[model samples]
Target: METFKIEGNVPLKGEITPQGAKNEALQILCAVLLTPEVVTINNIPDIIDVNKLISLLKNLGVKVTKIAKGSYTFQADAINMEYLESEAFKKEGSSLRGSIMIVGPLLARFGKGYIPKPGGDKIGRRRLDTHFEGLINLGAKFRYNKEDHFYGVESPRLKGATMLLDEASVTGTANIVMAAVLAEGKSAIYNAACEPYLQQLCKMLNRMGAKITGIGSNLLEIEGVTALNGCEHTILPDMIEIGSWIGLAAMTRSEITIKNVSWENLGVIPGTFRKLGITLEQKGDDIYIPAHTDGYEIQNYIDGSILTISDAPWPGFTPDLLSIVLVVATQARGSVLIHQKMFESRLFFVDKLIDMGAKIILCDPHRAVVIGHDFKSQLKATTMSSPDIRAGISLLIAALSAKGTSTIQNIEQIYRGYENIEERLKSLGAKIVSE
Candidate 1:
């Protein structure tokens, strides 16, 4: 039960590097199972969820070696098939949401994919129907055991087919793509998730001899290959963390430089923050955010209505950053509505903000209206427990901008995504201590 004691009212000023994308790492690591040869990966975030996934790979008899900090090589030549059905596996695989993605590569190579009920942030009903339904659409048999609470899919050989996904679910698309790459014949996936992570996955697979077209679009075309070879991949900088840095800079009136943020792939993140009247300067690959010394304000709609910052699929605003946006809005000069469309319960953490003297109204499970204090009213310190990863970091940003000392417990949730967060924040002049 570690806690973060963050002293508030100090402007954070320094340069910080965003870690490798956790969401991207999950898919790339799972893709390691697609080949028996060594798959080397760089820029791996040493986060709890990633380590748990790596441990799960080790349990499956994949040869994993740490070549360097944030780098690894995986060879899945000797998979232990028996472990997939073991009681220990069921519990371990169910511990993290990313574990479900393993089933896709496993099914592609070994003809069988089984996962126990996967666990993650209790944000809403994150259904596995998309993954299974996509697999089933590709001629795989699916089964769910109520007694053990397990999901399984198997096929002697996957036969490619054209399918339209119900939703452009990120992991679902990745799972299906992994399976489809090794499938026999041609496969076409329409309405697929075109996130940068997914695009990177497609590119890596292509490098490994999988013929995939439509790299950055929703319509993906894959020609089934008999086998895949090993390839090296470097993950993109985490856009979520980049957004967090932007929020922290504004909330604390800090002038900070986020280094090597992969500007081209940021897709509307910078513009979204700019809409909130935050100034950002791009230097080569880095983003320089100056202190909001004049205070920030929300932009209204063209019709003069209150502005709404909502989440959508990639190329649109990311749902992951809506929490950060909400926290940043608290100190702005105007009001904005946060609409979380994908996950329902993510906005529930606004209640905790209210307790800290924030003018936030929980409109529902999916929406919140934040009345920015314009730095006229400083947030009072309070003790709170973290509900999830994104919300925890958002609260940390809020705490740093607050007027007094704040204690945030259950920091383990924060560590699941952000690597060495307290250390990184401290280097950026944020007074956060882990105890």
Candidate 2:
């Protein structure tokens, strides 16, 4: 229920380091249930989702110990799978979408798993049909009751099979991969999600004795193994945070350098920003954002038309970042269409931007065309609540670039991913305070 009060138009100038990815950390923590040996994970972000997953693991009797800051040692030697049926388990499991991932590991090791309806952003109908379908293809039996909203899975001995996912759901692909690695035969997953998080999960699995081919591509061929041992792994830096920082620097005309960015993992994101005329300089592993660069016109087709930026599954611009990109486009000198293909309701927040004096046309549930009015430093101060993690950060960027003071409520949403964000930005000279 905390709020962020910001005084706008203050240029940020300093260095910022992104924390480990939240999506990746969730998967890595779930993988701990796959083995009884001790495993150490470094660079884990301290976030709400991670804390919830840790709580779930401790409830299952996994020996989780924090060795140092941003590092933990986990021993699942005494995992009590019976806790999956408790009311406390159901409540915490249904609190976040990532909790569903525990089902795969639990079923793989203990032959049974129980989960309630999962919760997450209310952007749209995020179906678990693909997850259920993929797990079923891997020889897991699923039963659910709609009235009670409870779901259960059981597999005496999982037999691997070919799976063609209906949609490339990122977490679905990861859940299936985790289950498939321990099945009886070879499993091939076509149309899989190859995002950086999944890639890190696959790499960690391979290091733990799982034979997985196609590390960064959609077609994954996983050879089933009888058992997996523990291994130490370090998570990759968060790319969404990197993208948000890039957008933040551009909007505030601030000179900032993002340190230790995984330059190779940023697929198609840098080029996509270039289309909006933002140039980023990469010095080794760092990205430098120059100060006060004139916003350029958005590029169009050869025939001179308005460009449209849309989201796709993987190797495309992430749907999570479209909000930030749309907010950044408001200060550009041209018109562009922002299409959020994955989520139907994510574009609804643009009404807040429209209230701030930007010219935007909401074409439909999934599309909005933003025409830049060159309205530099003209946004009126307003009170708004944080809708989601990415959208909250996008609003913060908009607020920092506006003319007057803006108060954003529910800052815990932003803290779900970014670490010490207010202090980091404050070090960079941004006028942001939490009240």
Model number with the top lDDT = 1
Model 2, 65: alpha-carbon shift in Å? 1.4
Residue-by-residue lDDT tens digits, candidate 2, 1-435:
799999998888889999999899999999999999999999999888788889889999999889999999999999887788788888989988899898888888888878899987778889899888988998888999897699888998889899799999889998899999999999999999999999999999998999999988999999999999999999999989999999998888889999999899989888888898787899999999887556656788689899999999889899989998899899888899999999898888888888888888999999999987555546677888888888889999999999899999988888876788888889999888898
Model 2 compared with the native: what TM-score?
0.98
Clashes of 1: 0
Ten consecutive residues with minimal summed lDDT in candidate 1?
423-432
Root-mean-square deviation of each candidate, in angstroms?
Answer: 0.7, 1.1
What lDDT would each prediction earn against the true structure?
0.93, 0.89
Work out the TM-score per prediction: 0.99, 0.98
Per-residue lDDT over 1-435 for candidate 1, one digit per residue giving the tens place of the 0 to 100 score: 999998999988999999999999999999999999999999999999999999999999999999999999999999998899999999999999999998888888999999999998989999988899888977889999999999999998998999999999999999999999999999999999999999999999999999999989999999999999999999999999999999999999999999999999999999999988899999999999999998998899999999999999888899999999999999998999999998989998888899999999888888899999999999988899899999999999989998899999999999999999888888888788999
lDDT at residue 88 of model 2 (Cα atoms): 86
